[model samples]
Target: MALPSPPLFIVFNASSGGADAEQASGRVGDLLTAAGRPHEIIRVRGDEELTRATVRASHAAREAHGAVVAAGGDGTLNAVAQVVWNADQVMGVLPQGTFNYFGRTHGMPTALDDSVAALLSAREQAVTVGLLGERVFLVNASVGLYPRLLEERESAKRRFGRRRVVALLSGLGTILRGGSVLTLELSVEGQTRVVRTRTLFVGNNELQLQEIGLRHAVDVEQGRLAAITLQPVSTLRTLWLLIRGALGRLDGAEGVDSFAFDQLVVRMRRRVRWVKVALDGEVLRMPPPLVFRTAPRPLRLLLPAAEAEEGSA
Candidate 1:
């Protein structure tokens, strides 16, 4: 598998997770250099610079017939993907996050040397992505308690460290504390049903869905998204549900409902102007009614040799 014969424009964020971006970039540079692949590393300082940096990288990649690479977490990848997808350029990943869901899902190596090596021989593949309204999400999108969990997990990471245990503990804490219930009117496949729950999660990544023990994971490969909603329950039951999710036995768990859909329209039964939604682990306020669906066009992702071959096979 041969990638585009041009320099790879990599957008790296220094503050994403606890990884040393300098060391990581240095390793990537060395690997690419050894492979004789010309590349440029764009270091981003803050979230404010993400769009500008990605746009710049996209333009450079477009001009050179190269691919734009994201070397941070899923959020960074999401930002870069938005620009690369819009620019109609191939995108690559160097996973540098605590949970590199997107990268792992696509069989991208997490090690810098191996990932760069993989990128050097990667092939382009079009992969499905989710859309939260007009915004693109590669992993998952959610509203309600799930987003709150992400917020709390981030705060815990800042206070403690960016480790899987910290993230797990923080999420458990959020779940134990409990949150406001949402009254949602969910419309899917021409059927509308009113439900009350703490969160509504729409998953596009099959690996993530499988991790959480949802059979709906298969739906993603079939050109559909997996939707999960929690029934309003006591804090203890919520905790039990969380345990089930962690144990990969959440499929038939009580108080949890999982289904597959191509499109879903969610409306708040209560009046509210904006809804706090999490897209690929980034929280933002989006105006309702929230629409979750498969993007019209798939993202041109640069997959590793094995995955690319499997995708073709």
Candidate 2:
């Protein structure tokens, strides 16, 4: 028999998705109450507060195996998941962010009411998580052009406010601005090779890869990481890949190679002291020689049963 579900501890970012987070949290609380599910909602302002709140929730939920739900975008979910990953506490998502990639990948609804309902009637599964040093990410991690795109997106958001159009314009600007390629020395599968690429992407979720027709990996739950490298190519070629990705046919895109591995050591041939890398939409500057591995410990996540079945099928 399965263990009893505990009271939910929700970590909500009110300023997310360009809406009043307080109003959103209130609405979620109302929904949970109406559903007769015992839940406690905690509002956080930034990453630090989110970490503290999740820690509190994790302790509070220990008695009942309750889940900790992140009510925001991939960045918010990433922060919360890092705190609760591989722990007894389960992780859930409300997906109130602009891209909702993590939630959608798990077959969860993006709407507030539907998301809460799904969480209340969800099951726990051991999901794979990617590890970059000490940080845990539920989505994908990358180096190169992707991080530059994220920087552009943040600048755009600050200047023109957060909107889908802004994100698009930001991406366009990044692609047009062009990016420098990295000479990477990679050690994987007991063989070492050198790659000159503009971007190196590591994916932890197969649903995301399949959505974009990336075919980076066949299974995310297989305790392995899916990595893709976009060779140094012309800006137009990169743009063409984006266009193909938009149409869900990126597999055949030229200059793109995908592979699977359990762990890998990546180094910059030029030996920079630090490099910009993006994990689950959050960018960070880390020391060179980034070591990436997969944690098969399985992060327990909540998703709608119907959608889960559909996704499995």
Candidate 3:
């Protein structure tokens, strides 16, 4: 089988691994070189560099006609994906940052050498990306308390271990037990429903509870978004529901709710200055009202060949 036309890839925030992208890039670079792949490596310093590199890479994807590989976490990926997605460019991931829930969930390898080897050896798949107020996300788009807490946790993840275990723990505690109970209105399928909830989630993909202390989504190619909201209730009951989810016992529970839709519109009970939204792992604010829609099959992603052959597709 011939490779799907060797692609030119752009890596954003290659220095995101903390020290420098040297070891990460070098290890991956060696593999690509051995595979006789053609690619480019660009270090993104700040917001400007991020924008420039992404746009250039997107245009290059059209002119040179190649895929853009976002090498960082969710934030960096969002910045780059927004530029190339739907602009006739395929997007890819390297998973060089914390958690990499979205990447690993999609069978993207974690180790630098293996991930690159697999990425270069992978076949492309049609996957959906999420759009939350001009920003693009590979896995999910979230608001209310969780996004706020995620910002602080990301730094801690960098300082500690890139696994982000502590942050996930702290985040789970903060959102479930300590999260805000705000009134929200949703417009789905042209029917608006109102509810007072502790947290609001609209996923380009759904999170499976069977995986404890783990975040994995339903396939992005499903062409739909999954939603879950919690109504204000006793703290203990809330804790129990979480425990159920943690212990893999949540099914048709009383306080738990989940739904799937193609589009969602959400507004908080209070009109604050701005509401924070977490895309992938990047945090940004959604001003007052947020309109979310599914971009189904908007991105063509390259995946490990084994995934495609083993009935994983």
Q: Best candidate, lDDT-wise?
A: 1
Q: Model 2 over residues 102-176: C-alpha lDDT tens digits?
A: 788777888878887888888776567889987898889999999989988988887897788999888988988
lDDT of each: 0.89, 0.83, 0.70
lDDT of 1 by residue, 1-313 (tens): 9654778999988875335777888888888888888899998876899999999998898888889999888988999988887777899999988889999999888887888888888889989998989899999999999999999999999889889999999999998898999999999999999999999999988988888899998889777899999999999988888888888899999889989988999999989999999999999999999999998999999999889989989
How far off is residue 7 in model 3, in Å? 3.7
Using lDDT as the yardstick, the better of models 1 and 3 is: 1
Per residue, candidate 3 scores C-alpha lDDT tens digits across 162-183 of: 5657776766666555766778
Question: Could you estimate the TM-score for every candidate?
Answer: 0.97, 0.91, 0.85
lDDT of 1 at 306: 88
> Which is superior by lDDT, 1 or 2?
1
lDDT of 3 at 261: 72
> Which ranking of candidates, highest TM-score first?
1, 2, 3
Best by TM-score: 1
TM-score of 1: 0.97
